[model samples]
Target: MKLPRSIRVIERGWLSANNIVLEERSEAVVVDSGYVAHAPQTLALLERALAGKKLARLVNTHCHSDHMGGNAAIQKKFGCAISIPQGEAPAIDNWDEQQLILAVADQRAQAFSYDDTFRDGDVLQMGGLDWQVIAAPGHDTHAVMFHSPEARVLISGDALWENGFGVVFPQLFGRETALAETRATLEAVGRLDVDVVIPGHGPPFGDAGAALERAFHRLEGYEQDIARLARHCAKVMLSFSLLEKRSMPLAELPAYVARVPILAELNSRYLRMTHAAMAEWLVNELERAGAAGRREGLLLARGE
Candidate 1:
């Protein structure tokens, strides 16, 4: 969906994030090329917008597989210089596939090279405009937001959203301060004159203040949920056993909580977290929240 003036939003569904195509002086720059599946469409959108003009630069908010999945593709197609967030540089430089890959285990992410780095307060001249870099790191430590202060526009990369924000899986990898950091990050983003917000996920919003407010509230609930689940005993084993039995059929409602790695490891140690445990916990959680009903050894999720 093309926005007014120089910004266009190219939706990539699940693989790549929605591409933000910025235009300037008939030349162009694309923000967040998205996943590998999105490279062709991203390139196509850029070609259509630029009409064969040079794609001046390729910038990433961070180096997640979803956001930078098309980085190599765009670099190959346009021969553009790729600049990502500074925190993302080392991770991308080494390319730990599992670390880079979205929702995956241990597989090292394929290594890709970036030409430069983006830091907070940096200005990127694109689409006949200058976009100021706004580093916000609730989702990924390295993630950065782009702002067109003149337009009161912000491209928030998984930091702020209409309803909620990204998961805090990185904390499991030893970053204890991640949640605290996320809270502080939100504080910074709230200070911006963001009349419009284009998040890494979901539709763009005109009232970013309202969006941020909703996200903040959701974050409180989400954090409480995560913490609550973490403290429970045998939760991981229960989740796994239940998921393994009925996971194939119930794809939409994820039975497994991948972010809770500690619980996953615990499942391996104590086999008490059995199928029955999972079934009980799931049913109990649902029952507690009034979102599910138990009937004949089966639990049904609530209909919206």
Candidate 2:
């Protein structure tokens, strides 16, 4: 489906979330800056897209490291006002690494402040369109999605991807409501009149019906077996680390998993495997999924 001319999506790889630009007459608004490691690239892309037009604001669907990693850089370059979900205000204001899952997952994002906060039911004007803020609480408890009813477009962050939504981190952390919340989020999205989806990690897709069905199937599997969910989270965390670092020494995998708080916690709670075993299992799983490769005593992130 063709997106509105005012909307532009800067598709990115797994390490970073895609950047969405809403160009107005004299100014523009950006949604979700990419990962911190790609801040320079994000700025370069924005410079080209904006073409001297003012970037009036930076908004986030959630507070994940990958999604908001380049916030500081964008603010520094464009001096745009940053706005985030109201639920995330406390965490972002304090720069709580644990609450934001940065230190917990061994991810990094430069701390940046927000000028305002938007909550569910709020309407934002961007690119001459009215986008309604809808609470999407599965991926991140406080996450929200923006939908433009007139444009029939949904900016679904990690909440609802084309294949499946993001890993339900709250479930891994023993939040009993996570699975239900995920299901509810999907139901909410299903109620929207969305003809196009701008997801956080992948290209914009028009098959919203098919995507929701797949997401429900994935959620059903997780709901039936929490252990499976734990394992999936572990593999994702490890893969993200590898993506950021490019490659890790084979010999250090075990220690690396043990040091990362989230990985270590997952191993302790659900997997209950020796650190070495957990590391080996993660590498094997990632390899089987084509997310990583081993060569010359190093585990390298493959195919992004």
Candidate 3:
């Protein structure tokens, strides 16, 4: 059934993402405009929700392309001032393709002018209520979560969810300590006295406490794998040594011998080590163990 147009959810389904619209008086404030593919639908939603009113402000939790995809479309249409978290001003301002999350496709995005900066403890008044800015890392290192205390609502950007957190690929992209910082942020979020959680991906969860508990429990198990990786860093170190002898791109290596997931996951966790360092660990560990061999610039496995 079609939900009432009030504060309608623009569920762009997949390619576009979702957007949250706030209607105040005749005016509106749209948050996280999804993607360019979803721009038309977002505008249509705004048209009905605004009811002849204009969009006063456009804001984003962080600068992920998907979150800010419709920025230009909205800006051109309503000419509203755009605001984002202070942590990601530069990337958001320039729309730097490399740093706007792990965008698999190499594509530049439409530019949007930045008007304001948000930080932790700051309140963004939307819909006649103050939405507090809460730092939420892990998914995007500079991401921020929005909280509206009066409504007990939280706009959790890829941080806490009904199941678990997003991929900790920020390290591969450049952000260090992404997982650690995210864990700390999630723990803090779990403690908040709230009733609903509107995450970046899942449906709005009414039982915030129970959802938070499940998220934390998932964190615990993930942490154990992280610890095991740290203790077994020598394994990856040895593997890279084999690859070094060949000279292949990282992606060409065999599954069992390649440092695709394991080492990448470790590097993402440490957040402190560079890809070069992480590569060194994998090569050294696997090469010496004879598990991997360097062949024609490619890292391959001796068996399986």
Candidate 4:
């Protein structure tokens, strides 16, 4: 799919969310600055893309580590103002690692201040188009997506991926409305007149209808079995850690899961397995799903 000449999508790997650059007349705006560990690369890429134009602002769909980790670096390098969803402003301002899922999930993001926040119904002019901010609450209760009606494009930040949406973390944490909110979010996406969807972690894709169908089906499965959702979340968290660390010693994998608050909570609440068993299951699941592989004494990230 051909995006507007003013808009550029930099598809990143699973460890980092994709970065979208919106070129304006004199300055540019960036959406979602990949993971903190990849900040240097992100800056390098933006330098080439922006050429000599100044970066006016940096915006985020949500404040997840992978999606907004590079905020501090970007702001320091370009002197760009940062904006985030109004719902996440408090967490960001307070630097609450628990609420941000950084400590809970064993993830990391640099603390950064935002100049402003946007809410649903707000219109942001980017790349010469007015993109409407839409609330998307499931993966992260404060997450949002952007849709440009004139361009028929949607920047879905882990809300509605081509194969499936992001993990509903609230559900695993015992939020009764999480599943329903996910359904509502998907239904809302179904109502949009979108020709292309630029997801947070994948390449831009067309065929929004098919993507919604797949997301709905996946949601239905999660609705049927909450344990299934927990297991999926466990695998995802583990795979993400593997991606960040490259490899982990097989002997320490069990202790690693036990030490991580989210993984420990998931095992106690849903899986109800011993730490060793949980680690074994996670390793096997990742290998089976082609997300990880066991080599010698290490569990290595695969197909990232």
Leading candidate by lDDT:
2
Please tell me which model should have the higher lDDT, number 2 or number 3. 2
Per-candidate clashes come to 9, 0, 23, 0
TM-scores for the candidates: 0.75, 0.98, 0.69, 0.98
Poorest 10 consecutive residues by lDDT, candidate 4: 167-176
What candidate 1 gets wrong by more than 4 Å, as runs, is: 1-4, 101-110, 228-304
Model 3 error, position 288 (Å): 35
lDDT of 4 by residue, 1-304 (tens): 6788899998898889999999989899999999999999999999988999999999999999999999999999999999999999999989999888898898999999999999999999988999999999899888999999999999999998999988886355556688899999999998899999999988999999999999999999989999999888899999888899999999998899999999998888899999999999999999999888898999988776
- The predicted structure with the larger lDDT, 1 or 2, is 2
Worst lDDT window (10 residues) for model 1? 244-253
User: Tens digit of lDDT per residue, candidate 1, span 1-304?
Assistant: 2244888777555335778888776577888877555567767876776677788788888877668877887888889888888887777767765456433431112346888887988998867777899777766777888888887888887787776665554335555566666787788878888778887767787877677688677667646665442323333233323322332223322344323344443343433355445445555765575555555546554432
The better candidate by TM-score, 3 or 4, is: 4
Off by over 4 Å in 2: 170-174
At residue 158, candidate 4 shows an lDDT of: 93
Model 3 lDDT per residue over 246-301, tens place: 34455543332334444455555653466665555565556676776666656665
